[model samples]
Target: MPLPTADTPWPPVDTRVLTSLADWDAWYSAEPERLEQRYEGRGSLEQANRPAQYAGGLRGRLARWFWGQPTPAGEKSSKLHIPLAGDIARTSSGLLFSEPPALISEHQGTQDRLDAMAKSLHPTLLEAGEVCAALGGAYFRVVWDDEVSDRPWIDTVAADRAVPEFRYGRLTAVTFWTVLDSGDTNDRRLFRHLERHEKGRIFHGLYEGSLTALGAARPLADHPDTAPLAAMVDAEGGLDTGAPAHLTASYMPNVRPARAWRHIPSAAYWGQSDFQGIEGLMDALDEAWTSWMRDLQDGRSRIIVGDHLLQSLGPGKGVRWEDRRVYTGLNMLPRAGDPDPITSVQFAIRVKEHADTCAALTEQAARQAGYSASTFGEHGDGQAVTATEIKARERRSLATRARKALYADPALSDILAAQLAVEAGFRFGVTGLDLSVPPKVEFQDSVTEGLGELATTAELLRRAEAASTETLVRMQHPDWDDQQVTAEVAAILGESGRAVSDPTMTGAEGPGTHGSGPVE
Candidate 1:
């Protein structure tokens, strides 16, 4: 059935909804802030004497070089410790891939078709979605035959572009909006709204632009294929239709029509940034390094040019002695007065201590992000060497990964399902197989813990008869389903030339008995 028109009144959004979305906007801004600190060394040094260091000339260059201050305000630097934390999280999270799960019958064929379609599209969906998840939450929209492109396309809208309408803690509708340049003689507003129907799984688009140089507001015409949208516009060029045409054009056989869209929230239950936890630590590390650099440059050296001695050199008292032997070498010159002529004394700052402290803070930051010292190539002091064992898994990194998977897995599945629906509707056949059965998508996780910890557990299970072979195999390969496990067991027995025996045989222990040997 067709969905309602865009002109129908939407449930009024609560004031808190706007506030919540604003928070997500702030969260998204953090990525650029982090990038600035990482590559540009922004806020690296805000010392009391920063203005002096920024004043151009030989003095500014000397202070910047010797004091470890950032480059002039507009330029960027190569300082990178802050970016390293973000890199660690991304690299350690592992590679996530999509495939058909056990839920779908003949899922392999469905998955292969989805894979081929993904390759044909630009800015592969995987890369786009990952970037959005890292920043906060993103809206994945599957648009077909947009004015900009003829091919079916997947576009990721940032959180700010997607306004999610909620009812009783569930998302009922999502309105994806954007701005366009209408190229009128006068600078006028041009807004576009593409809303998705949650119940009917359809898309409704409306464009409002200044139709003339006078800057008068009017509803723009619909695309040639979407003529039904014209009904929504009233005589005054306002929205009038209460329903929009089903926008997706499907060409595949056996594919049901559905919306191929997904909303991936980086953190569960709300939009949370991946870098929120470690941002403070990164700032602290930068501050510590900045302070150390400032003190090392300004506090550790002194020049003793006396007030009485200044008159001898006149205006040249600010000596150009940098290259002369008199700068570092001791020169005993005759003094006219008996009073001490030494004008100043400067003590060296504790450079080594500050460096060690910063290192410790950096390590703590890594730990908070679920990384160890070894992750950044740093060795812990007096660390113990113990046998490899499966340690407890409760780090922020792991938790974040799990939470993202919780959202991404289902979202990806829905995207592929929608694609299948479109293909089936259009009867656009696959290469070799019949895509009659809708395929369920599953994401394959190739990321593991830092120490290859799973290997030790697998070895222990193989060496000792801790449980039934099936149970052991399941533990080792958690992603494997029951059928795969059974097939593996049968293959093993066949290779060993052993016959299977029933556990409930005569004179044998019945079910529910403990301390039993391997099932074979």
Candidate 2:
């Protein structure tokens, strides 16, 4: 890395500055490093596609014969990545607000239009699902191109590169980083988008690096065309084609109407990765497995030879008893009058104790990950696991999912807000949505329930007509949107040639009663 240029101002960072900032470096690099190690297994980098190392003993040799001692990355990391984080992101991505965002004007048609626009943007906003799993949180930015169209579009920023700047306890700027493609696709130029709020005005600045070697860690500059101080950014930058951007632009005033939402409240930084809390457990489990393998390999066999015969054999091989002049296979010579001279000896090693200890260790590791001993193919104590015990373990896993939802739900709301704002400018298809009024983000819990519990929920939904239809529908199918529910209802009505009238509608009779109105 290079030294930071003292003359450069804030928000413009070169490689040295980026890697130097304590929090920034930790967030973007250090944390990912630790998480990746836990996921791929420690020392994976050093091992890099190599075979396993075994001790020089009977146990080591036996392990190679029985298990083949082929060490691969993540062999220790059974990726107990339960559906918690994934389910949270997957469920939250498809969530809907309790009600459509309200408009300032009381025009029902306009409100409906806005609702339609919101529905259209729902799937786009949901693109952050896998992103959230990769990074504990996901980001949403509203973008528009003056030359292309006036309508705003969504830009989902990866959490690893998205930096939100706060000034006086308020978010004043957001900077996103990307690697710009150069002549070589593998090599890249670093680019940054710094959207800042200054004097009640939004300023957008684009930064590009000059060196192809910048690859992933290019330097940044306020001015685009000037050759980036590679020496100041990275000591290695001079080695690459230190070619700066041919085109440059000054910080230009942004005229877009949307302001970036730093994070959704539910998604306001509350995600815990599968590997987060159990990293130490994973490390210990890996070590235990590795040690167990060594024990199995080195302790399974032994060979012995008589002292006088050993000299004649010279390390397990010598001339046969029949052929005395030259060395021969599977034969040893005995001295004259040598009584009770054992030629060679071999014995099988009983590894029951070592095997049992390994099994126990494997079980303990699995238990730490909230799984049964059998999950990792280790039978501890040789006890059969019951169905009830499995179900209870599954129930315990729900806690992780519940915690993820607490953060993901609010973050989804922030993303939805950005999406709603972007969709506000659509000239056709959607109207009546007010970008000023934030929509309510409602997370539908999709955790598996017992059959009895599911029955109870179904019965309750069937009996209550006024209860939240959306909630009921979500309870049944968490991934379904209002549009899907409508389609399902339409399909059902089409079958009977009759519609189920809404009890809340004006002049409606009873729930599930046939009505003249066609389902929307």
Q: lDDT values of the candidates?
A: 0.47, 0.41
TM accuracy, model 1:
0.53
TM-scores of the models, in the order given: 0.53, 0.45
Model 2 C-alpha lDDT per residue in residues 1-520, reported as the tens digit of each score: 1322222433343433232222222222324343343233322455422232255666455334212334354575322112222332343333322222222224454456445556645554456544553344455655444556645555566555545544443333455545434445665445543343222123333454443222122244533432333223233332211112100111111111112212433122223322233334433434455555665566654444455444354566764333257755645565586644543443444467546654565455445434444433343356645545545544533444344445544444444454444354332223555555444544443334655665577778768854444455566675576799766656655675765455556454555454434442
lDDT of each residue in 1-520, candidate 1, tens digit only: 1222333322223334333443333333444343343323322423323554566888566445321354556665533233544454344434232322233436566656655665553244444444444444555655554456533555566554555654543344566555555455475554454554443255455555332111222333533423455564344333411112222211110011111111333212334444445555665676677677767667856667654444344475653323245544446676577346655678778788888987788778767644555545565355644322112222444444455556655554554555555444433332443445445545444343333455566667767866556675676677787889988877666676663445555344654254432346
- Which parts of model 2 have CA positions greater than 4 angstroms off? 1-136, 143-155, 167-172, 181-278, 295-396, 425-430, 449-520
Give the Å shift of residue 448 in candidate 1. 4.4
Worst 10 residues of 1 by lDDT: 250-259
